[model samples]
Target: MRDGGETVTFDFAPMVDIVLLLLIFFFLTSSLGARQTALPLDLPRASSAVKESPALPIVSVDPAGKVYLNGEATPLTSLGARLRPLAQASGGVVGLRADENGQYGTVVEVMDVIRRAGGTRLALGTRLPAASGATP
Candidate 1:
């Protein structure tokens, strides 16, 4: 009867746990985003083009017929060496991007090199046409 009452305090263990969980979640997801490093080029338009998986290696060809592998300027003759390992790592899947104005023969030669380099699956990159009546 002599003592009145005592003060209470909040526990911070739950708050710390929630913060840790959020930190881990962001760290994991950040690495899963698209990591393409290919050079920027005006890709050909295709009605059937679809979104490609991010795991594949990208090879880009500019209008002047210069080939780039994963954003690095590479000679067409040496592409085989770089592509072989990439194809093996990605289960033979490789992404190809060629500028619309690029020479047709160059594109064909690149494809042939990719095939010889152990790439069994090929994905050509193209932009999808805008919907009709859409403003720029």
Candidate 2:
């Protein structure tokens, strides 16, 4: 052997464990926030929809006419009481994310509820269409 040097090995088990724990922690915590966009709703496409603040409260309407507050299912009757404080805090600005195929009447009713809940301004959620700068 021509003056060979000793080889050293690294034990990556602890680092890997820490990385896995961090990953799980982040995943669990991230889901705890307002997840209006987390739903599988097919949003209507728009040519001009800008990003808004995340702190703005969100009201979601699924295809089945069910209502949700920040990703948690809520009934229509109690939506006002629940949304009042958030609306006031956000200066009456609330975001609405409704499924594109959802009933129009239901969406309108939900909007009414949001308005009555002290939300003076509505920020409707929409996505850009596949065709660049095209409206859907």
Candidate 3:
């Protein structure tokens, strides 16, 4: 046999490693974003808003009328009692996060509760419009 031929091969290990790294990076980042918000909520859009401070007390209302105090599920009847201390500690300013599509009655009730809990000022949670690429 008198035949001379050369073959070239491409290694895919490096390419696969890069793809895996990218996948892991995206997965980690996406999960991290979810950590900022206690629960999933479709917040109302606002044209002007500022970054929320972590020091403020946070109250959230879900679409099903469930209430949350800084991520923990709280009963409507006892929310005021539980939130009172936080409100006072935060200087009577509380951050309220209510889902845009949630029950209007629940949101109103939550607001009333916040007021009764000694939260004199409310920092309503709203998302910046899609047109404006900003974080708040």
Candidate 4:
């Protein structure tokens, strides 16, 4: 070695492999969030409602009393028939997200229908009211 110069060495193969492994790890570990319904329902606000970490399957009941499962409108009479198969397939809880302005009787009716359809587990979706003087 005559004049000493800095040796240039670059190997990105290991870095690339590490990155790919990390990506795969994240993809495999991340929880799949709950599926949403197609129909939009303005849920009632609550001062104490807590947000669930993972979203739940939402069945929307509009002000007009129309029922929607996973966003597709289903007739009240056929609600149980339609929901049973979905519940069986998902092995997950079914839930209702109804407009606050909507009638309570309608929500009860929907619950009754769901129960009759063999949906044993159900949840209600709501968001907590913003704290006073806090930015939303």
Candidate 5:
């Protein structure tokens, strides 16, 4: 014997628990993205490679000819100003990352700007290709 006025209710506790679990899972699994500017460029391969030192500041040059300093896009004229403090703070070493498709002239220009900015030590970023049959 059921009353005509009776209403049914749905339980959302389980659903909320599942949702929270999924949120936690994703939060734990998601990578902390690289701390660098979004420079869409493929780096050139190298035969001799070395591990990157974390202490150095990075400069990126994208294929579109945009320059990034410490993961932020900055004007060429202001590059020296931007880098001067960093150079003094970091003792003058600035790492350079340039795309393979990017023009050499652009890289040179960026290097020139860095030099004028008082950057003394510069390191070019590179990745070692898969080992070929040829011996080193």
Candidate 6:
């Protein structure tokens, strides 16, 4: 390349491709890690828990049977009304993050409230069971 009478060229196609890839990566991940409750709980293990799209509202039930709707504590009596709008907005789908140690009755009651609130699709959040003797 001669500096006196000629100019050098730069290829930006690779840079554009890399930028696009990163953009897509972040976009996909941002949606995948949708809003979740701050409470820490041990999720049950399942072999067939599938990820639902269009991220739905999260209903977290802690070990003591405390229920959180979108991270806000709400009485079970008012849960239906509180969740109705969210369920409708999310296309009648909802996510339930019940702690594995939570009482079964509480979970069932919560599910009933969810259904009464017009949630037609329920996704129970769970992780795959760890290998034997492996910390989850």
Residue ranges of candidate 1 with Cα displaced over 4 Å? 1-10, 14-18, 21-25, 28-34, 131-136
Give me the displacement of residue 88 in model 1, in angstroms. 1.0
For TM-score, candidate 4 versus 6, the one ahead is 6
lDDT of 4 by residue, 24-106 (tens): 88877774545563455666666667665344445788888888887788898888888877666545567778887787898
TM-score per candidate: 0.76, 0.70, 0.68, 0.64, 0.65, 0.66
For model 3, the run of ten residues with the poorest summed lDDT = 29-38
Best by TM-score: 1
Tell me, what's the RMSD of every candidate? 4.3, 5.5, 9.2, 5.2, 8.5, 5.2
Candidate 5 Cα deviation (angstroms), residue 100: 0.8
Per-residue lDDT tens digits for candidate 3, residues 40-119, read 98888887777788778899998898999988899999999999998999899999998999999998999999999999
Q: What's the lDDT for all of these models?
A: 0.87, 0.88, 0.88, 0.73, 0.80, 0.86
Q: Which runs in model 6 stand beyond 4 Å of their true positions?
A: 1-34, 52-54, 129-136
lDDT of 2 by residue, 1-136 (tens): 2357757678999999999999999999888866544878888877677886788998989899999898888999999999999999999999999999998998999999999999999999997556555444
Look at candidate 6 and give me any clashing residue pairs.
none
Q: Which runs of model 4 end up more than 4 angstroms from their true locations? A: 1-11, 21-33, 37-40, 53-55, 88-92, 133-136
Candidate 2: residue 76 lDDT (0-100): 93
lDDT score, candidate 2: 0.88
lDDT of 6 by residue, 1-136 (tens): 6979888899999999999999999999988775754788788878665664546888889999999998889899999999999999998889898898888899999999999999998888887655574654
Provide the global lDDT of candidate 6 against the true structure: 0.86
Q: Which residue pairs clash in candidate 5?
A: none
Where's the lowest-lDDT run of ten residues in candidate 6?
A: 127-136
Better of 1 and 2 by TM-score: 1
Which scores higher on TM-score, 1 or 4? 1
